[model samples]
Target: MSKHFWQTVGLGTIAGFRSMTAPALLTGNLAKFHPQALAGSPLRYLQKPLVATGFKLLAGGELVGDKLPQTPNRIAPPVLLGRLLSGALVGATLYKINHGKTLNGALLGSAVAGLATFGSFWLRKKTTDESGLPSALVGGLEDILVLSSGLALSKGTDIGAPAGRAL
Candidate 1:
C-alpha cells in the first residue's frame, strides 16, 4: 500500500533465507551508528536484566531442559533447532515490528534477514567447514531479526511515499 510497505516486504523475503545475521547487522549497526532509530525492539533485549542472566547461562555452555549427549549423538536436534530458530525468530521479528497489525515490519525484517543469510552462506564457502560457526551464526542472526523487527514494528510509523508513484 505504501513505499515503506514494499520495503518491509523486501526485507522479510531476505530474512526468510537467513534470520540471525540480518538483525544483528541492523541492531548492532543501529546501536553504534543510528542510536536515534533504536526503539523498543527486541534488539534492546540484549541489555535487559533477565537477559543478562540468560547470557551467562549460555556463556557457561549449559543446556536447558536436558543435558546434551557427548559424542556419537544424533545431529538432528541441533540442526532442527537451527532451522526452527531461523524461521521462528525471523517470523516473530516481522510480526513484532508490524505491531500485530501489518505485514510491513515482517517484510522489512525479512529483507534484512535475507542479506545476512546470503553473506553468511557466501563466507561459509571459504571456511574449512570444520566448525559449526556457520549454522550458529545463521541461527543467532535469525533470532535478532525476528525479535527486533517484531518489536520495532509494534510501534512503527508509516513513512514516505508509495513505490511506482510520483511524490
Candidate 2:
C-alpha cells in the first residue's frame, strides 16, 4: 500500500471520532479546490459559501449539543449511522484524490468509525473519571482536537509519517 493509503486510514481513524466534522472539512476543501467535481451532485448547490458556513454551523452545533445533558451517546443507532456515512464520504473523497477504489475507502472509513465510537467513548470516560474534570470540559478539548485533526487531513499534511518520522 502507498503512503496515501495509510494517510487515508489515519484520517479515517480521526473521522471515527469526529464523524461529522471530518466530512464537513472535506466538503469545505472540495468546494475550495474542486468545485466542478461537486457539480450535478445534490451538494453542488452548496457552493463555497454555503458549504463553509453550513458545515461549520453543523459542526459547532454538534460540539455544543454534545455538552448538553440530553445528548445521545455517540454509539446510538441513528448517531452511529450518521457517523458511518460521514466517515465513508470523507474516506471515499480521500481515496478519490489518490486515484484509488472508493469501496476500499468506504470500508476503511466505516470500520474505523465503528471502532473509534467504542474506543473514544471508553477513553473519554476514563479521562474524565481520572482527571476529575467535568465532562463538558473534556468534550471541549475533544472538539479542539477533532477540529484540528479535520483541518490537517483536509490539507493533506504529513499524516503518513509515524510520530517521530520526518516529513
Number of the predicted model whose lDDT against the real structure is largest:
2
* Residue 41, candidate 2: C-alpha displacement in angstroms: 6.5
Segments in model 1 whose C-alpha atoms lie over 4 Å from true places: 1-19, 29-43, 46-75, 101-167
| Candidate 1, 72-145: lDDT as tens digits | 11123553344334434434443443344334354444444455445544554344265545544544554455
What would the per-residue lDDT of candidate 2 be over residues 14-116, giving only the tens digit for each residue? 6667666765666665565553433454444434667667877887788888899898888889888877877677666555555567688778877887788
TM-scores, all candidates, are: 0.30, 0.79
What value of lDDT does candidate 2 attain over all alpha carbons?
0.68
Give residue 160's error in model 1 in angstroms.
Answer: 16
Model 1's TM-score against the true structure: 0.30
